[model samples]
Target: MESLVVPVLILLAVVAGVTVAYRAARKRKTGRPASQAEPAKAPQELARAAADRLSEDEHRRVYALIAQGQAMAAIKLYYEITGEGLRASRDAVGALAAHPQPFRRQEPAQAVEEDDDEPQRFPYRYRAIASKGDVTREVSSNMLNDEIYGRIRTLARSGDTEAAANALTRHSDISLTQAREFIALLDD
Candidate 1:
């Protein structure tokens, strides 16, 4: 009888511990303090707005981690670079991978600060390619640099295919139909 009583007490203790743990988890998920919860981020139209957010070296390192399938490391790098909440960092890294943005060398502060409506000419022509299986399409233009191309890709990824196609047409001499086709490939 003594042995049975000891076993019963142990079982009760285990049950109590499980109950406490379950309640704690529930509280964290449903009733967490406002300070402990991450604030929701605004949905930006263009993910390219983050191009200048991370330096070239960090961008390259994160891309390398992504290529090697170390997603968690890439997310950690993004979190460190942007100082964003963990969930936001995860989403940013995922968007980067899905959209495949290129690292742009940082421009001079003066050049960036001068926000004129005129398009700045790049020293070298830029080339962007999208392929699905045997169908490959390439867009080469002096005006279509990494930032613009990244914005175009972001538009395509966000389901604004027509806007992306229009942006491509405006940037390049390609016809609307051709731009649509290229945008379609990017969406794929």
Candidate 2:
């Protein structure tokens, strides 16, 4: 009985040590230092430069697709026209949707023209991902953007989880149940 007690105590200690190590590993993997954090708002300069690469026709076509809520098609068109990689095309389209630009004709002799500011629609879906520890969540919807997602994150971090979940469900196609589940996984 004495020998068994020592072995059981050693086994319990090992198990506790392993559990602590696993939790620490998860925390390290999920936590980001201040310097490594991504900017909430994407840089607009990249979008402006990418807008110059599209011709008048392509520009109109991409915007029309965006207006029609065809994000994947718009991304495919941008990739085909620019010969850029898939990720670059996706980023450029996201930027363009966020900040609309007028079509620019490639003719050197012709001057650029500005379109009316009639609130162009970019009704394309965006995917926002949140992860902490071993849990990961993704929200896909047309109503989400950097600003709205940032607000949601702020709400989640501030412990207003119900408000965040409600706002998420209101803005996204997700159900209230799903929104709550997603919100619960956010880093508090």
Task: Compare the candidates by TM-score and give the number of the best one.
Answer: 1
Global local distance difference test of model 1: 0.80
Tens-place lDDT per residue, model 1, 58-173, is 87898899899999999998888899899878888777777777777776766455222355667778888999888999888776787899888999999999999988887776
Candidate 2 on 1-188: residue-level lDDT in tens? 89899999999999999988887776677695434655644548767867899988889999999899999999999999999999889999989998998876666866535222221224787898877788888998877777778888899999999999988887787899999989988875
TM-score, candidate number 1? 0.38
Output the lDDT of residue 29, model 1.
Answer: 85
Top of the candidates by lDDT: 2
What is each predicted model's overall lDDT from 0 to 1? 0.80, 0.82
Candidate 1, after superposition: displacement of residue 139 in Å? 0.6
Candidate 2 stretches with Cα past 4 Å from truth are: 1-42, 106-188
